[model samples]
Target: MKIWGYLSALTVAILFGVWFSLDKTLLGYLHPIVLASATYLIASCFLFIINFSPLKKKILKIINSKSKVEDFITKKEYGILFLTAIFGSVIAPAIYLNGLNRITAVNAALLANVEILFIILIGVFFLKEHVKRKDIVGFVFLLIGAIFLSTNNLQNIHFDASLFGSILVIVSCFFWSMDTSLSKFLSHKSNIIYITALKCAIGGLILLLISISLGLSFSLPLDKLPLLLFIGLVCLSISLPLIYFAIRIIGSTRTGSIFALSSLFGAITAFLVLGEPLTVTQLSFGVLMIIGVYILYMGDNDQNV
Candidate 1:
């Protein structure tokens, strides 16, 4: 991993840390589906404004050069892009936000670190990436930390609502893992801005249609529009592209390992911004997660993974 790789990972961690906490706050004002749809819609609009001209010129340049546009973005890439939209921007957000509504932002952020596990699984099996012993050890630490956070340090053992919420977050991470791997591949095919923009636009449209079918309220307070814009621009637009760039540079597993820091950043941000209490258990498990991520960082070699 290069310095830019590390920078991208840390930047995404901080951005998503604040974004996840604000997501919990927004859930109070808007339904999960509605908020997801609206925010992504805003992101789509922002991307269009920023990239439409550049993308148009690029496409025309390709045409003028007598190269097949398909050479740049093929049918298979389109298919992968559609899947990324469905899983990344649509289903993953819906499930994660629903789970976030059920649980604390701190817990949601912590469990989201499990995305690295799923990403590794997918990479090793489907993508045929090699995993090392140190990677496994780091994963163990992260798993233990996640278990501690989910179980509240062994205080809550039963399969209660909190457990269910944790499961939902885990499942959401699984989908996001799929999205991350596919998006990494896609980054080689197209500009991250174009891919992120188009995916969010299509996914937002789908979610909005679903919200309409489900008769969910579409109304948002006048004061909250700016917050939604901030989320769209900062979280979805800027942060997502950076994550894709990191995935391209460092691979999903390494990127995700560094992304585990989002839990620590998110928990602290939730405490400060949302006034969520930072309990001893949360803090302890957060430290454990940081240790796990540090191990992961140490384990990475000078290679791309």
Candidate 2:
């Protein structure tokens, strides 16, 4: 991975951190599924508009000529795309939403850092990606920092010790991690804009139908539309594409390590915007996380991930 890859991952952390903080207000008023469905629908619509030209050209090319266009998507790619929708769009988010319902959004975001561990495992062992000594050392620092951040500087090393909700959040992280790893398979095989648009479309439609079938209302007051648009257009639409681009270039494991900063960013955002307190210990741990990421990429310019 180059600097852009790392930068993209870092941006995702910041975006999700801020989004989760803002999302707290909405979660207080709406069912998680209903909210997710609406935001995803908006994201899909926005992405489709961006993908429209290439989408039409590809369809026409396939029908009108035998020669492949640069952005042509294959059946195997579509299969992987659908799997990502299932894991990323539906299963992981649904489970995380339920877990988030039981705990604070900050805690839920912190718990999701466990996805880094799963990503590294799958990327290294399953995908056969290489690991350097510094990467391991940096990952150790990130992991420890994440632990400290979540546990309040070892005050709750057990991580909310006995909360089943916490466990649920971590479990959901694993599924999302799988989706992250699976996403790497799509990097060079298809045009991400179209693929991601379709992903959000499939996932959003499924979630919408499920929400309606469960008698959850899609209606929202005018006052709420602005925030909803921000969640969908910026958080969902923008963030998903950036993460995919980073993973495409950097590979999942390295991208995930940087993305783990979401926990620290979330805590700070909550403290600043939501009046949640940020203790000195958490700040210190957050510094360690920065150091970890810096060390993780110390020699990245020398070689690509």
Candidate 3:
């Protein structure tokens, strides 16, 4: 991968970390569905504006022939892309926000890393991607770290700590993993900006309807306006576009692994912002997780060699 690509991917991960922490703060003031709807709406608008710009039009034309665009983007493609939007942008954020409300931001952040494991599993089994023995070993370390992170009150496991929220996050992860894989396949045939915009617009519309039906409030205080905009621009607009670029540049498996670092950043941010307590176990597990990630990455390098 290019150095710029890796840096961009890392940047996305860090922004995602900050986004999760800020999302918790935002959730205190707004419903997750409403927040998601607004963010996606903002993202969609941004994508639409960019897609229609002369610069992007030229780039899009160069990347895809007009005939290819028409042929590649069938109803089947739209259907798949819409489902991707539903799972990734709509359901995932809703679950994550709900879980964030129920648990500490640190715990929620760490648990969200489970998506890496899910992605790897889906890639290996369903997608028929190669998986080395070391990858499996790395996954074990990640699982161990997750256990340490999840055990907030070691003496008392909180099963009631948003089981529904957790399930939603997991399902969201599954959808996102599938989306990532599908995006990679689709990129060969179509413009990524078009695919991304479609997902955001369709997904945002769905969530908007749900938010309205659920009677979620959309009111925002003047003081909270800046944070909401920051979240919308930085987290939703910037980070998501970067994620798409990262997926295109690095491929999903590597992107997924690198993205796993978001958990570590989230943990540190939670400690600083939320004053969440950090135990020795969590710290040690974090180190192990990093080492495992390094090992897995090295294995990937070896295969390429």
Top-TM-score candidate index: 1
User: What lDDT is obtained when candidate 1 is compared to the true structure?
Assistant: 0.79
lDDT scores for all predictions? Answer: 0.79, 0.73, 0.71
Worst 10 residues of 1 by lDDT: 62-71
Off by over 4 Å in 3: 55-72, 162-171, 301-305
Candidate 1 accuracy as TM-score: 0.89
Residues 1-305, candidate 2: write the lDDT tens digits: 35666787889888877776677767777788888787888999998887776565674343224222246667887898899998888877777776777766666666666777677667678877667898788779767865654555566545454355666767777888888888877765445677778889888889888998999876777898899999889988878877777776676767777777887778777778777766676566666766776676676652334
RMSD of each: 3.9, 4.9, 3.5
Residue 116's C-alpha lDDT in candidate 2? 74
Candidate 2 Cα outliers beyond 4 Å, as residue runs: 53-70, 130-162, 285-304
TM-score of each: 0.89, 0.81, 0.86
Write down the lDDT that model 2 would get: 0.73
Compare the candidates by lDDT and give the number of the best one. 1
User: Which of candidates 2 and 3 reaches a greater TM-score?
Assistant: 3
> Cα deviation in Å at residue 1, candidate 2?
9.6
Ranking by lDDT: 1, 2, 3
